[model samples]
Structure formats: C-alpha cells, structure tokens
Target: MGSINYDDSDVLDVLIVGAGISGINAAYRLHDELPDKKYLILENREQLGGTWDLFKYPGIRSDSDLHTFGYAFKEWTGADIAGGAEILAYLKKVAEDNGIAERIRYKSKVEAADWSTEERCWFVTVNQDGEQKNYRARFLYTCTGYYDYNKVLHAEIPGIKNFKGKVVHPQFWDLKEDDYRGKRVAVIGSGATAITLIPSMANVTKDITLVQRSPTYILSLEKYDPIAKVIRAILPKRMAAFVIRQKNIARIYASFHIFRTFPGVAKAILGRLTKSQLPSDIPLDPHFKPNYNPWDQRLCICPDGDFYTTLREGKAHIATGHIDQVTSNEIILKNGERIPCDIIVTATGLKLSVGGHIKTTVDKKTVDPSERFVWKGSMIEGLPNYALSIGYTNASWTLGSDCTAQYVVRLIKHMDKYHKSSVVPKPSNRDQLTQRPLLDLNSTYVKKAEKDLPKAATSGPWRMRTNYWYDLVQAKYGGYDDLVFA
Candidate 1:
C-alpha cells in the first residue's frame, strides 16, 4: 500500500474509484467533459485492468465479441476478438493515450468513504503503501465491478482439502510453466470458464474430462466478422461502431425471440444441431435446458465450434453428474463411479458482489444497498453526489455501461447548469416497492449477489430489462428525461 497527503484547501469535484474497464471509462469521460473540475481516480492494484489482469489462465478470451466489449469511443484493432492480455493492454493504452494515467493513484485502496449531509461532500479515507490519508470530494463514482476481488473460491466441496491432485481455480492461474502436458485433466462447471478451458486443454493434456453439474447451451459465430471488416474499410471507425452494434443487437434479438416465443422451432433447430454433434443415445435434458430462452441468460458463444469440434475429435470428454467427493487422484461421481484425473481445474465460477468487495458508507453509518433504489442503474436513491456504472447482465456490458456513462455526462451537465453540488434519487414509496436482485437469472454471479443488491423503484424503471434495444431507448431517450435532479 502507498500513501499521499492531501492538501485540505483543494477539494476534488469528483473521486472515481477502481481502475478497471468501468473506472477507466468514467475517468476518461469525466476529464473530457469537465476538464476544469478536479477529479482523482484511486485504484488498489499496482496496475489497471481489474479482472483481465487478475485472471491469467490459458485460452482466456472475451466470452463476447470484441466490438461490444471494447469501449464505444475506442476501436479494437488487434486480432482474435480480444483475449485477456490484449484487452488489458488495450485498456492500458487507453489510459496512456488520453493522459488519464497521471490522474490515477495506483495502490491506493479506499478503506472508507463518509458522506456529510451538512457539507454535501464525501470524506474519503484511503490507504497507500501502508499509510492512510484523507481527502474530500463533492461527488463519488464507483466502477469496481461486481465480484470478490481477492481469491475466488468454490462453494466448498465436502473434502476439497483432502484432494491430492493439482487443484487450481482459473482465477488464480499461475502463468509459469507448471506443466499439465500429457496429464489427465478434469475441468468442473459448465460456465464460460469451464467450457473454454475444457476443449482447449484437451490438446495439451493427455485427456480432459469436463465435469458439469448441468449442460450449457452454446452458439457459434465467426471469430472475425467479414461485414465488420467491410464496414471498417468504407466508414469511419466510430460510424462502423454504430452500424455494427445495431446489426449485432438485431441478430441476437431475432435469435432469442424465436427461442422464447416459438419453442418448437428453437428446439427443432437446436435438436438437429445437437444430434449432428453428439451421439443419438446421449441425453439432452430439457431440465438443464434454460427455462426462459437464449440471450435471457447470456448466450455463450463458441467460434468455429471449438468446444464441439474438440469433443467430437476424441480429445475431450463431457461428464455431467454430481461429484460425491474428491479422491486422492480422481473424482467420485454420485452414481458410485470414479473418474481419474491428474489435474483439476475448478472453473466452478466466481462469487459476485458489487464494487468488487468495496464497502460503501454514507455519513459514517453502514448503509444496506438494498434499502436504496437504483435509478436507471446509475443513481442510487437517497445518495447525493454519487453515481455508479452498472453493466448489462444480458447484453454487452460495455454497451450498457457506455450508455450509462452518456447519461452520467448528461446528468453532470444538468447539475452544472443549476450550480448544484449534489443530486440524489428520491423514491415516491421506498418500502412499498417490490425489490429483487437486479438480474434474477441463474448465472453464478447473479445467484451470488442477487440477495443483497439494490432494487429499482416501482418495478418499471427499476425493473431491469436485459434487452439491448429496450435499454438503448431508455438510456438514450425515455427514462433519462424523467430523472429529477433538483
């Protein structure tokens, strides 16, 4: 940890926390919109790129296409739909290119932030290099993504500690050469992490056993878009962004509409595809089949049918069952069967919490986030001089976050116009509203954090729709106008 002394005379207009995708974008937009307003971005890590830099597993790439994952203002020029390292570098370059790096205080972790009702400012306490310091800001902005920042873990298997094989979580993958080549590997979970790792590890390892409690429905798309290339050649990069975004959104929407409204049609198409890929005897249970529809819970994308292709080639094996226990060198399935493996990759998934383990307090009183209402998923009820950049659970995260940023800039302009120092969300009936997790969909992160999250007011504006077009209209036109700042 590092520390810096703040001069009391200089009160920051805004304090941005976290240096990840959301934070960087917020800072970049803030400086671009309000160059005269003093703002400081504080990050706990020595480096930026929160999750991308943190996870160093092999074959770590964006689950979504790079076009939507990358910032709206910037273009992703490199290859492979943006892998973890590439994305990390891209974020770093964004900071360096815009001169925002100088404004970032590395290794400065915000220990506490107290809001003052009388003064209408936030008393921020942060630790740096083992030293604690204090500062004050008129507004506070947090972009620290939802997840446990340190050591990601499984839900604690009965005898996990007794396992003798090399047990590793994708979150803490060691980059050094701890060879898994020629070794039997077992990958747990059917999420993006497990699915991606299973097929890829098959080539390196002797064999890979994909252990899944349930099956994940996967869709394939071209890694690089021919149309995107053509558009990039003809139009400016930003213009291409708008066109491509619309095209992708439409494609996803059409696919999902069929899956939801016409289940028979969706099943027929998926059934044929599954039959072509797998043996007829293999069961495709509709129980594990998603209830709502595709794109309801994120539609997992696989380019070139990589996972399917590898499975058919006899390199990888999929095992769907409950693991009874971990043996010294193998896993015991619930059906009195044992599967042996030399290495275990628990892609069991990440724990989700807002702001990455950040604890937020107002006026020195511990605030339950659930008590506040989320207005447009950016402003929290009863909290003044603060804003959050919350991404979409169903759609592209950057798309939604960027949309929120656009709204944030508008809100800032509105505040400036009125010479207002603070803006808070005031709900008509806070207790009467039906509150639920922002996203009730059964993904790992959603399930983890849904219980304690803040809700929307009156369920209409607060009711989050994962639909891109719906959010686009709300963000760009409808819902933003209704928000009262005064």
Candidate 2:
C-alpha cells in the first residue's frame, strides 16, 4: 500500500535484480531470516511475477506441478496444476503477505553491477523511469530469467517478411489490440505455449495451424486445479503447504528418476499415450524425437487431451513439415505447399538468464560475467558473499531455488556469528572438474556461457546430478560441508 524512498547514496545489505520467482524468494527469505537487514528488489516491469506477468498468451499454465513450483514458506492451496493468472495472483499474495511489496522498486531496470573489492560491496546502476540512479549493497542476486527480453520469432522461410498478416510472438502477446476472432491463426512451435494457445484460440479463430520445426514429446496433465481447491477446504494453512510440497516433490522425483534410468521405458509408455490421443497418421519419429533423453528440454503438457481433441475436431491442424518461407498471404512449407493464415504466432523458446545478468568488474577490469564458473549453480567461484538462485531443470524451479535460498540464509547466519565479511565457495580441484549442467548436453544457455561456467567435476556430489533425487541428496545433506569460507 505504501513505499520506501531511499537516497541513491545509501548502501543496503542486499540488492536483488529482477522481481521474478527467484528474486522474490530471495527477498522473502532475507526479510524473514534476517529481519534487521536492509534489502531492495529492482524490477523492470510495473508488476511483479516476471514471466507470469510478461506472458499474456491464451491458455497459459504451468508445465511443472504447482506443488513443487511454489515457495517453501508458502503453501500452494489451489488445484494441482495452476493457470498463469492464478499463479500470478498467488505470487502477488506471497509478496503482500510477507510485506515484500514495499521493498520492490517497480519500473527500475538495473543497467550494471560492479564489484568493489576495496569496499567489499557491489555498485548497482539502475534506470528508474528516465532517471539513472545508483545503489550499493554488500551482496547481489540476479533472477531475470534466461529470456533476453525478446519475443522468439523464427524466420518463416522465404517471403516471410512479405506476408500481409499480423505476426506475433507469444512472449509479446497483446491481448487488447490483437484480434484473433474469425481469423485464421497459425501458431508455430510445439512447445507448451503453442500447444496451450492453439487449443484455446481454436474456439474463437476461424482455424488454427499448429506449425513446428520438429515434434516434441507431448503429455496430458490434470486439467483442473485440484490441489488448490482441496487445500482451501480441508487443511490448515501450514500443514496443507507442507503436504503439497512433499507430494509434488515425491511425484516429480519418482517420475524423473524412472525416465532417466529407463529411457526406453518412458519412451514406450509415452508413445502409446501419444498414439492413443492423436490420429494414427501423425508421424512420431526422428523428427519429434529429441537427440537427447526425455525431460531434457521439458515435455509439453496438454491437459486431458485438449490439444489432441482440438485437432481431431478440425478446428486445428498440425503441420509437421519444415517452413520454406512466408508470403504476403500464406506460409510456404519446404515441400512447396502453402497454407494461408491471417495471424502468425511464434512460440519458439525462451532465453535463459543466469544470475539475472549482473555485470561484475574486478580491479577495473571487466569480468565477462558469463566467464566465471558457477559453484553449485548458486555461488560464483571467485565472488565473495554472492549467490545465484538458479533452480532444477527437471523438477520444479521452486524446489531447487527455495532450497538454495534457505541454505544461503543459513550460511549468512553462520557468518554473522563469527563476524565474517564474506563466505566464498572454495571448491576442490576435483570438484571443479566434475561440475556439469544439471541436465547434460548442449543447451543454448550452457553452451553460450560454458567458458565462464564452473567446470563441473566428474566425481562426487559436485559432479552435477541432473537427477532430482541426487540433487536433493546433495542439496540436503551431501558435500555441502566441504565448501570452505574465510
């Protein structure tokens, strides 16, 4: 309801960039665990809930179960799988309930962050409205997410730019101005956004073209928000929260493990499910098959065969062929077949942001922020009293992020008792060699920042466990004590 005005010259305990899930969680943890500490969160958007607020595409929902995706301190009382708006509302409540709203500076975009070795703090530069301001803090955390603030619009082959139709990217959906009613809309990409948007848009649009470069593994989810409703009725707030988290965590880990240990088994089961849901003619082959294992890039979810049913009824059509180009009135496939559409929706993918894009300079020399290796995906090797809150790739992000926040809180508390100025992640040589992407294989983000990323050790807990169970084991009780601090 109110706000806090701070002078640019003042220094704070922690300065967090990006008010997304990670940044919000970090601020909440800091406020609750160390109430006396000073902190602030800089958000570029007017609202909180970074991704949730940014994406307004139709039929948006969570791919990960809300149970594990939710904050550890707050219970998810809604149905099992929450929609985007519902999730956004829940996040807003989390901030409001914890009095975190006052600490967030809306519309303030951070330009850069420089580490001052002499001052033992970070100098944060932010652009609020039209004014540039500066803030100093002892610690910095980035949660801007991987997407580079750009809508993913792939080239639609030859003559795409000439197309007279309105082209849109899901990341930059405009609900008010863009009208889909009675228009033939072609939604590209087979990922979650395209799958979800296609089914819903079919109801209003004249027809829908579901285009894709390759086929992705599609699965059905529980359509209704059962978890939220059940918790609201029967359980106390705290207990309901705990049960939801535990249940979701168990289910995710169990499923992830089964898929990882037996890829063939997962493929076989999922294959049957897919065939039974869609038409038999739709080829599910090397085109749809991922070069890596399942759960590698995230499986797309369509609750209760909504997407399949939409296609079956003829409101939507799935185009598996490659695109050759876009003309003024139609999309031409590599096979030379042209399909006419009034609007085009591209849901290609998202950019991954690590450490919220904080720029760090040491000794007046710019350290390519992407060059430093990440320690346990949280702390950078050479940075003191700094932590990155990246989450699990397979499981819900909140599961990993919340755990990381708690660990950081505890670590901070431990340091305070000894009057320590910093707590750095000093990994052994073996540990450094073993660190790998939680999910192996070349991802755009991992490959782009590999040189700056910590070399994952091949052995020990630090070796990089893509499995949820292994990560839980390590984050909970294994090898953490070995991280040295001075």
Candidate 3:
C-alpha cells in the first residue's frame, strides 16, 4: 500500500511502530477507545503481521493457543494452534475489520525519533519508498517485538563455511517453493522452531535429523478446544468467546503456577503425558525429558503430537549432542558421531532488536534505553509518552499486549483529562534497587542479547515480570501514582 498523506491528522497524537500482533492490538484499541485521538502505525516491512508474515517455513504455527494468542478485542476462529499464514490472515483481518489498515504505512521504516522537550512531542523519521519522511507525534509506542527484525541470531558453528550443503535460518527461509523431497535434512537446536521444523520437513524429505546440544520440553496439544467450540455453538458469539478466552487463559496460568510450585509433580504429569504419546521404541530419558524445569525455556507444543508421531513413523530422528564441526555433507558431533545431511537448518534463536533499531533522542541527547529501568515490562523509565508491548513468556503473548494497550489508552485519557502532555515512569529509589534482566526467559534468544536489553528494578514500579494474570489487573488498572505527569 502507498503511504497516505495523512490529511486528517498530519501530526498524530500517537505513532505506533511495527504492525505485528502487538501493533494490530494497539491500533484496534486506539481506534475504538480513543476515537478523537489520531494515530498511525509505521511498519518497516511491505506488509502487516510482523512475525506471521515473516516466518513462512512449513508447519510454522503458534506455540501458544489462539484463544490467548488472539487479541482480547478480536476472537480467533481457527484451531488451537494456527499456521503462520493463517495467523497473518488473522492479523490482517483484525486491522481491516477495525479500520486500522488505512492508517498503516507499509515500508515506512522508522530510523530515528527525536524527543523535543520544548514542544513535548516526538519527531519521527521514516524511510518510505526509498525516501526519508518525517512525522511528529505526542506519544510513541513500540510493538516491534523483542527479536531482531533484520535476522535471527543463528548459532555460529565452526567450519560451517566449508560445508558444501545449503545452510538456512528460519528467519529468512528465502525460497517460497522450497522442496526437500528425498533430501536429507539436519536441523540444529531444540527450541520451538526446530520442533516445528522437524515434523514439517519430514513430510517432504526422505529423512530429517534434529541435532541439539540438549533437549527441550515438547508437549502435545489438542487439535481443537471442544469446550470452546461447544460454548460458541450455544452462547452469543462474543459472550462465548470472552468466557472461553478467560477460562483458557486461567488454565494456562494455573498450569504455570503448578509447574513452578510443584516441580516434581509437574514433571511427572508432563513426563507421563509425553511418554504416552511417544512410540515404545523411542526413549524418554533424554529425548523427551529436559534437565531444566518446565517453563525455564518456553515449552514447545506439537499439535496432536505431530513431532512425536513423525518420529513414530520413522520419518524423523532427534540427535542430542554438541557439534564438533561440519564437513561437506555431514555434521560431526563432538562425541565422535557424524550425521549425514544435505541441508543444515539452524533454529539457533533470535536476537533482541529493542525498539526495531529506531534511534531515540531525548532533548538532543541520545537515549540509551538499555540503561533505563523498565516499568511493568511495558514502558521504560525516563521515557515520556512511550510504552513497549512485550508479551508474556509464561503465557500467551497477546494477554500482556491486550492489557498493556488498554493501560496505555487509560494513561492517555488520564493525560487528556488532567490537561497533561507527557507521562513517564520515574524510579522511586534507583540506586538502592537491584537490577535484574528485563525478561526471565532462559531461551537462547533472550539470553543472547541480554546486554542490549533494558533492566528491571528489583522491587518497585520499575519492576516487571511475565505474569498474565498479575498484569491484567496491575498493568491495566494499576495505580498511576508511580508515573510522573507534566
């Protein structure tokens, strides 16, 4: 879509970056809740639906259920786990249905934003259609996501350059019509991506070998939610959806609590469930069991036990070992085992691209976002009229995004009511509080870019954790006293 002139409101009240799942939610909330307030979404890519549009690999589906993965305002009518294309379609539908499409400027990559203290506004620069365009807004909100937009940080294996076979990262699966028919594929890493890729590639390839340093917890998910489907058939569309959504979200959190509170019980429950699904031939000691507790890393889900089923069919294999090096057509394990393959799929993980590489300057000075403390995992300290739409690690992502968007709207309305121009979260006792990682995710992706990420205060308004239930009330309706308004 061509960039609009934005005649109605050239100077928007808010400027949202990234048109992904988080951006779509933010836009819908902004449109319906704050009708009078003008806003526009600046997406770097040529289309909306950030993650969904980007990841086109086979079997690219949501790990989190659509009931919670979907926005609070919008209902996901698909299965519990949806494919990448379907998710993208859902995001686009949300934007189109909510009148957010027109306000989105595709290919409008925001390179830098300068905060003018005198005007109490932000001047944003976007690279659109090979031209640098400027726009001003009262507030700036980012749903750019935590991962690097440019590329996924694939693990750098030694002697990979010497390997003759094609190496590809899931972030940029360039060939749309890629066919691995009769080809031997070796996938590296044991995260969600690898789990999804193994079963998917196995269908088309002769053999698929998943090589990993360690195994991660991969659970089996029901293909559909029968209760929700039954509830929808009986109750009003929206009412049933709301009820089902709330119930599902609660179950997710409760499960998480159980895992944390009673690790042994949780392990046994998960272990038994996994063992029941796996074929008797496959061992559960190392393949299914992870040394870490559940949720230490984001638990991967195989819809209808597809991954295990693939293994049961003898179409796929999981090899847990350290990589010594890669020769022309094989991966030599450090333990002196060599796996032959024609393709190496690196599901290493993603890097944190905080704020989508958009440079932010406060009062002509560059704002080092990493140095500032994050307040409630949504907004950064010392940054006025700005918030980040980071989703939950323990639960579905949209849970946090949906509530955080509402909270942002509430904050904006409060500002308007009091005739205030800016709102910022100021630390109560910065020096006294201990700093912690911005996210508790132990995944390689979150850990890779720890240094560049913002810090959280140990105990204060500046503290943030991944709790959907806590955030629903605390983030959405929490006290505004922690914020400084001017």
- Pairs with backbone N, CA or C atoms under 3 Å apart (clashes), candidate 1: 1-128, 1-129, 1-130, 2-128, 2-129, 3-128, 456-462
User: TM-score of the candidate numbered 2?
Assistant: 0.89
Angstrom error of the Cα, residue 92, model 2: value is: 1.1
Candidate 2: tens digits of C-alpha lDDT, residues 1-486: 233456646788888788888888988888887887788889999999988998888888888877778877787766666789999999899898887888889989887777777777788788898799899888787777655674352443556679788887878888543388889888777777888898878888888888777777888877655665586469877887777677667777787778989999898888888777776556657435555667666777787778888866878887767888887878878877667899988776665455555566654667664544566666766677677776777777776676667667776776689787666565566434644553453444345545544444556434443555455555545445436665
CA lDDT, candidate 1, residue 61:
83
The best candidate in terms of lDDT: 3
- Tens digit of per-residue lDDT, candidate 1, span 1-486: 122344534788888888989888887777677667677788888989888888878778888777777877787765525578889999999998877777788888888788887888998888976899887898888888767787574565656677887888898886343478889888887788876787667787888888876666776667788888888899987787778767776765677677768877776676566657664444556313544455445666677678778877788877777789987888887877677888888888777656444556777777677667787777777677777778876656777677666667667777789887777777665566787667646776567666667775436566655676666576556644335554
Candidate 3, poorest ten consecutive residues by summed lDDT: 1-10
| Candidate 3 lDDT, 273-344, residue by residue in tens | 888878887788877788889877788888989998998899998787789999999999888988899888
TM-scores for the candidates: 0.91, 0.89, 0.96
- Residue 415 local lDDT, model 2: 69
lDDT of each: 0.74, 0.73, 0.85
Error of 2 at 236 (Å): 4.6
| Model 1 root-mean-square deviation | 3.6
Native-referenced Cα lDDT, model 3: 0.85
Where is model 1 poorest over a 10-residue stretch in terms of lDDT? Answer: 1-10
